[model samples]
Target: MKRKRTISLNSSSITTRSKTRAAAAAAAAKFYLPDDCWESVFKFVINDKSKFKNRRYLNSLSLVSKQFLSITNSLNLSLTIYNGSRPFLRRLFQRFTNLTSLDLTWYDRDLNKLLCQISRFPLNLTTLTSLTCSRVDSLRSGDMCLIADCFPNLQLLDLSYCSYVSEEGILQVLRRCCKLRHLNLANCSKIELHGMNFEVPNLEVLNLSRTSVDDETLYMISQSCRGLLQLLLRSCYVTERGVNYVIENCTQLREINLRGCCKVHASFVASMLLSRPSLREIIVPSLRHFSVTEREFFKRHICLVY
Candidate 1:
């Protein structure tokens, strides 16, 4: 009777072990992410389609299975065509659909036709949130307007070092992208404020450092972009009034950079700092120390600068 009992226990233990292994295998087979999910991850990782930094990894993914290859080849990814990439832009652009962002900062001044082709993406009559394109002289105002009209969801536009982009391009972007939050026009020498009216209610950060902005344009931007929080106007022509408007009206402003803006008066800068009690720091040409009284004034009186 003892031998029979021991044998029965052993048999039950073996049965339990086998059942657990089988259940685990079944769960893995049923609950794993489908092939389509993997494709989405791949698309998000490679925002720039023209040249992926990890070519070896992408190639390995392509070899995983036919299903993956199908998705990879499908038009459901964001694309970028860097200037020196081997494949043509046409072939690269033909593969992607549902693209939400694009970075085309790798062009050699031939963007007219390419801009037209890019305008055919998922966004229609809307602006893109992030556009890092190189401006071209050949691009007419109409072409620029068309490009701006394409990305309705544009929030951050980086036209840095694009010499071809003028005031018209800036205006076009500002007019179309009402929700623009960050505008980087660094080294865009042609952006002037004369006769320019922009309404960017959601603009929080604007970097026009080293650009050709006079006092009038700077003041205009101050009035239009009331929600501005941080502004960089280094080496630009900014007077006392322009500084006053920004410091007084943009109550949420934390940092105001006037490095190389030689026209700004010291008195105006002091007042700006005092008005915005919440201002943590100001990037001036020579910022060595702050007096106790100045600090106290800022802490006490700057709660209502706007």
Candidate 2:
């Protein structure tokens, strides 16, 4: 009743007549939209981190189609490395080639070797703009030099609370990072009391709080960093004379923190408020009282008196 059903007996065929009435079965594969759609989705996810943490979200997306993975990798511009993430640094660097900011605040490991590895990569000047290595116990002068050599174009560097860093280390940063706008050396007390003198014209915000920053260093800073917007000398041993030099030189200073300077007097601070119209905020020493005139003057000028 049925016509003859013939099958080819080609040896090259994966399935032959010997395997009768049988074939492999598979599920439907997932599909993806065009490149533009993937790009939009990647951007949305990268910006909306409420659903997934940054690295984890990216890692999950990378398991998708190749196009989606590529889009995610391209959209990732920042990375926060952990102490245990040292082994994967190379891979992370290779993937997030567009990183402009790196936060190493939590990483307390062998920073010298880590920096050496980062320097080897072909990262552009614009590849990294902001870097934070604050509170690093093992930071050294060589490490600071490595930072200058690796990311010379860094605009914001936070080296505050580091256990040890010599004047030479801080000096290297000021010299090599020509574009440095903000530098935090708070509590890096190991810096020499006299030798840290270098020019950083572009430096806008400098924190020398709780260090051995003497009047000479302060004067040198005033001369060098004239465009300073925020100068933090909290708990430093600087005097009214040194502070006077800063107020006179740094014409663009919007905020100054002089809290805890034993040598600075409130009368001098009152004079600063009266003289410097550009000041938006002033943090005077504790236990010092401001006169009614000083208070009224600061209020009149819209300057924050603390």
Candidate 3:
């Protein structure tokens, strides 16, 4: 009986020591790592290339601890709202205070109401750099002015397929948004540009595809936006002369889309391709005019997209 009791006491002492060690380890894990270190780790993990993986990892991390949840919320800078309501917009602004980019391309609602909500709220959106409201047909000149007022620090604005926004609205944007770099007015057929000496010096990428942008407008673009890198003039009214002028003046131009631009002939394109070594890609409608050797030569220097 004595021997058995001694053995039982020894087993109890071992069990108690094991439980104490485990409790100490749990405490260490809970308090050892600093918040900044954890923030860096979370940032690295959340910035994974695959969106699906990043979201999954973020969701799982948020459930790990309160610190993780706060970090996740603070680091989320980009947001895309498809069906945004006033209440929802308010909630989003409240939740993510550091939003730098917003995409409402898929938002199927009246922009006036949205703008009203923005105007009503004293939201700190100075950090916003990119805004895409593509296909929002109801956006008028007044709406563009409102956007300029709200997002003064905007660098990239995509108003593609918003046919209702005319030259008045576009000019308003160009005048106000001086920091604008990339502007996409693709398929805005009604934008009428006469003899206006507008200049967007910082403007780099412009898409006037399928618009009635003629040589005069092209000349204005060449003069104003000299630093233009990529220009898309597909299906535009610009002729070979305009194309040549742009090529000669806009020395920084790398890629130009001339697809469906029926007036832009092959000879001008070939001459520009030979003259401008800076030209990287020229997307045309056809390559039938070029001989096999000529085609090979052109291909070696630049990308000939059909």
Instruction: Give the per-residue lDDT digits (tens) of candidate 1, residues 220-259.
Output: 8777887888888888887877787777777788777787
Model 2 lDDT tens row, 106-136: 9888899989888886655467899998888
Give all candidate RMSDs, comma-separated: 8.8, 6.1, 4.4
Question: Which ranges of candidate 3 are over 4 A from the true structure?
Answer: 1-26, 29-31, 50-53, 299-306
Identify the superior model by TM-score, candidate 2 or candidate 3: 3
* TM-score (C-alpha) between model 3 and the true structure: 0.84
Q: lDDT (0-100) at residue 2 of candidate 1?
A: 100
Expressed as tens digits, the lDDT of each residue in 67-104 for candidate 3 is 77877777777777766345688788887788888887
**Clashing residue pairs, candidate 2?**
none
What does the lDDT read for residue 286 in candidate 1? 43
Superior by lDDT: candidate 1 or candidate 3: 3
lDDT of 2 at 102: 90
The candidate maximizing TM-score is 3
User: What TM-score would you give candidate 1 relative to the actual structure?
Assistant: 0.71
* Clash-forming residue pairs, model 3: none
